[model samples]
Every structure is written in C-alpha cells, then in structure tokens.
Target: MNGAANIDQGLGVSIDLRATPKPGSFYRGKRHAGLIDVDQKGAFPVSQYWEPIYHDDTNEIILDPDEFYILASREAVTIPASHAAEMVPFNPLVGEFRCIMRAFSTRLWHE
Candidate 1:
C-alpha cells in the first residue's frame, strides 16, 4: 500500500544515508527478488500480478534513484494455524529502506 501520510510528508527532504539513521533491513529470502524491465516483451502478468524480468546489455536490473520496482519474494512464510497477520512496512520516514506488497485489484497480496 502506498502510504498516504508518507507521501504527504517526504515531499522534498533530499534522502541520503549520510544521516546515519537507524538502519532497516529487508528479509530477502533464498530466492531473493528480480526486477521487471521496461523493455520486457511477451504476455503481461496482469492476472498473476507478477512483474517481468528486467535485463540490459549487462543482463542486470538497473536501479534508478528514488524509483520503486515490483518484486517477487521467495521467502518462506509459515503462519500459525490460529494466528492472523498483516504486512506492515518498517518505516517510510527513514526512506533509507521501505517495502510495499501490492497485488492485483482482485486481491491485496498474492503468492
């Protein structure tokens, strides 16, 4: 979910790591994640809500400054039989690192 309040706050703060602020790390599973390139072809993953693989001459996804990408995490998630959970981001205020899991309109999150 795009944080409504976060968008309104960090209008032009000039994000950087020089602040040495509290660090927030992500749990990239064994499969990690891949990027979808704008030049990707073939079928669009509308139903699956999956992004395409980004590739360049180096065959690596180039990360742009202050840009977001739709990634697929292969992390193993095991929920307790009687437990319920929600996907919450660490801290958008940091802007050093933040994550958002957005699925297709059919659902909020996907496998």
Candidate 2:
C-alpha cells in the first residue's frame, strides 16, 4: 500500500510512543485520530487521518515529554483460510505503529 502521495513520504515525521505505558486510561469505546506528513517539501497540504483505539481496560501509564496517550483495540478480528496477518509493534526508526500485512501459509497454500 505504498504510494508516492502517502503522507508518510511527505512530512518526515515519525511517531515513537511505545515507551509510554499501555492500558493507562479507561476509555469507554472512544476513538482518537491524527495526521502526519513525511515529505516536508511543501508540495502537499497537511495530510491527516483518524486513528481510533478502543479504550476499555486500565493499565499502567507512563508520562514523558516524548510520550503519547496509549490506545487499545475495540473489536476482535479473525482471518479466513488462505490468508493470515501479522501484528508488528511500531519502531519509530523502522515502521509505523498500526502497520498490518498479509501472511502466507506455505503448507496450506500448497496443499
């Protein structure tokens, strides 16, 4: 899903909030969203999007100048056969927080 017009390629802004404690606040199914641009070339307008996380349970909270509020998922999902997914945590220097991808099932696909 990589695109030249993608926001990530326009702002040079990277988010690293994993250091912040998780399950900190008890939210009753509230969603939070924001936007980021990575190009910084001044060629595109502010690229924005909504990132809503389901807040239900309570967990430890970490307060840091570089930390952002923790979020949780609301609904559970299941993948059907011939398809799979991966949940990779965000590494500011490497990937995005909500990065998701399809996984291949070698044996099942061959069978």
Candidate 3:
C-alpha cells in the first residue's frame, strides 16, 4: 500500500470514505451546484463504486491502485486529558486507522 505515515505518531484510521460519490444523491435537494457538508458522508453505493476490489455482501470497500479516498471512523477513541498517544499502524496498508494527522498530535483528545 502506498500511504503517508509518521512512525512517532499514531496511525490514522477511518471508517468511511466518499468514493465515486452518487451523482443522484447530490442533485436531489438543493438543485444548486457544488457540494454540501453532508455529501462527504461516504454515501457511495455499490453501483457508483469503481474500486477493483469490493465486498458486495460485507459492505467493505477497497480503493484501486494509487487512488485516494475520504475515510470515516468506525468507532470513537479518546485520549485522556493531558495525555498523549501515538497511533500504531495496523495491517501495514489497509483499514481506517492510517495516518492523516492534520489536527492530530498531543493535546486534549479526539473523537
């Protein structure tokens, strides 16, 4: 897997992604152009998905080679106040817990 990571920090994890987004879902309400905050909710159905590997029965998805996807977390984790934790990598190249430390690092906590 081709990903970006910082070993000292914890790995980034995400549960969902906005892959191949559904065109119909966006054109339904506003009738305007552009995007809405809710559109980023990883709503792409199996039909709109183009990933080479996808689990139709499991609802599990995998991106194609060299493709980027928006990630969503399946669960919530909290680092206690005044405490710092490093994200450990899991599976080396899969799952939501990868690295995307935009606003991450030591501090209060994250959800």
Candidate 4:
C-alpha cells in the first residue's frame, strides 16, 4: 500500500521511508560494474559493502552529500500481471537527486 494519503495527477503515489523509524544503510566510494557471471551472486565487489546507517533521536537519517545509498520503500508494492509500474527516480520539486537501479543495488545519490 502507498503511504501517501492521496494519489497525484500523474497517477503516482509517494512512498515515504522516513515516515517510519527504521535504520537504513548506505555505500560509499566510487561506483563500477565489471564483467559478472549471471550464475554467480556478488561476483565482483562494487564500491564499499553496505554500511549501516543510524537515525538521530528525532528519527531522522542523516545522509552525506555526494554519497550513494540504497533505500527501500516502506510499503511492498504489488502490480497485476497485466499491469506494470515504473519507478520515477527523482522529483525536482521534492529535491535534486538521482537513483540508478543496477544488478547489485538501487543506488540513490542525494545532492
């Protein structure tokens, strides 16, 4: 289920991870992707491994600028077999950022 109270004109709902008090994680260092075997899991280590992220007393996760993070939605979404869903990485009105979904992780860069 979407966490947003209402859906927008674009027929998209917002999923807020920060709304819930849950510890997140991030990865630092340069990003890269070399030759990988489809049969192997984590064939080559990309950047640093997943590091735990802690929230402050107010339950706010402080992220460093220009760093890469992989965060999940608070809600688990399910689409019909005939239907599909596309993830819009960023919204300028919300903030300037970028998200790239790779074979390893869904990287989110906060500007």
Candidate 5:
C-alpha cells in the first residue's frame, strides 16, 4: 500500500511495520540475513554492522528474523527553513510496506 499524509511541523513522523508470523534469522555472513547501509557520509560511524534487537521476555539475546530489519542514518541533517523533502524507498521488499522520511536538525531515521 502506497499513500501520503501531511506532516505538521514540530511533530515527528511515526511508522509501524506489521509483525511477521515467523521471524527470520538475522546473522552476519549467513544466507538470507538482512543488511542495511547509509549513503550519507558520516551518517553511520561504523559503515557496516549488524542491527540490534531487544529481547521481550527474559531480556536475554533473541535473534531477530531476517525477514525484516531496521537501520538508521548516522549523519544529522538540517532542513533549511521554507524547504521540504520527500523520502522514497527504492527496491524494498514486496508485500505491504511503508517508508517515512522527515527532516531533522541533524539526524535521519530509517527502519
């Protein structure tokens, strides 16, 4: 599903991805592992790395499925006054996905 909604100034944009029934495995150097990277210089201190996951039950390490993952840009971006930008996802996984892009004084959010 693709659509657009107005985002008011001073309010942050929010996005939610539907949970998969069976989460896939997330591991570096493994087949079907989810990988992400930021093109903006200095956006990510570490150019490449595995994404972090939080354990919901015992607070122990829980491997997230490879079906989906989230990544954020390390570089902070400032939107000049009177200017707006739109974020569009290229070649994303199929089946009902949404991408939200907002301007921050010095940051970019991706999931």
Candidate 6:
C-alpha cells in the first residue's frame, strides 16, 4: 500500500493517512543535550530546543545534515489502543530513507 492507504484486517482498522502537510509544523533541533536531568521536572517547551523551520520562496524545506528536524508527516496516523505501530526505516518503493524514534524526558507533550 501507499503512504495514504488504509489497511483492513478482520476486526481491526488501520490508520488513515492525510496528503497535506500541516502549516507551521516543522521544527529543527538546535543541539543535542547529551544528558537530561531526570530529577528536574518542569515545563519543557519544544520551542526551547526546536526552532521553526524556514522554507524558501518555493515553500520547500531543505534539510541540513548536521541538524535534526522534527518533520510533520503529511500522513495522519491513529493507532488503536489494542494495537501498536512501528516505523519502517526504508521502503523499497519510496527509495532510501531513515526513521528514528526517540523518547523524550519531559511531562509536556506536543503533536
């Protein structure tokens, strides 16, 4: 299936993928904080570390190899409570790509 396809299995329903990228959703990481203080707990705004991505006149986002960007997928995914989702590093049909998942040490969440 493509990026926007819905998979149907027995009594399970797959996630629905959208086509348009959300506006003002791209953020780039300023720098990697090697270690986070688990003892300290407070408001950890995403803006503190990530800044809004600047697009060119053509509205194209050029990625920097040295920086990490939190890109919003054009697809919207909703996983069922009884099921789980996994990221595929690469899809042959889509060519070369990499997917990395990280768990942040913070109470505040943003989607």
Model 3: how far residue 73 lies from native, Å? 1.8
Worst 10 residues of 3 by lDDT: 23-32
TM-score of each: 0.28, 0.20, 0.31, 0.46, 0.24, 0.53
* C-alpha lDDT of residue 91 in model 6: 53
Q: How many collisions per candidate? A: 1, 9, 14, 0, 9, 0
lDDT of 3 by residue, 1-111 (tens): 357434454445555433443322111111223333433444433223322232355555645444444333444555557966665656755643434432321121212
Candidate 4 C-alpha lDDT tens digits along 1-111: 456434344344333534543444334444453344545554444434455554555756655665666655554445557964566656665455554334235332111
lDDT of 5: 0.35
On TM-score, the stronger of 2 and 5 is 5
Residue 30 of model 3: what lDDT? 18
- Give me the runs in candidate 1 sitting further than 4 Å from their true place: 1-53, 56-59, 78-95, 102-111
Best by TM-score: 6
Which of 4 and 6 is ahead in lDDT?
6
lDDT of each: 0.36, 0.32, 0.38, 0.47, 0.35, 0.51
Residue range 12-109, candidate 5, lDDT tens digits: 43322233222212212234433434445335322133344433444334333443343233333455579865554434553332233323212422
Query: What ranges in model 3 sit over 4 Å off?
Result: 1-58, 93-97, 101-111
In model 4, what lDDT does residue 87 have?
A: 60
Order the candidates by TM-score, highest first — what do you get?
A: 6, 4, 3, 1, 5, 2
Better of 2 and 6 by TM-score: 6
Q: Is 1 or 2 the stronger prediction by TM-score?
A: 1
Candidate 3 accuracy as lDDT: 0.38
Best by lDDT: 6
lDDT of 4: 0.47
RMSD of each: 14.4, 18.8, 12.8, 7.0, 14.1, 7.1
lDDT of 6 by residue, 1-107 (tens): 45744555322322112333444356677686444454445545566666876554565666665677666544455555797565544456544434333233234
Q: Better model by TM-score, 2 or 4?
A: 4
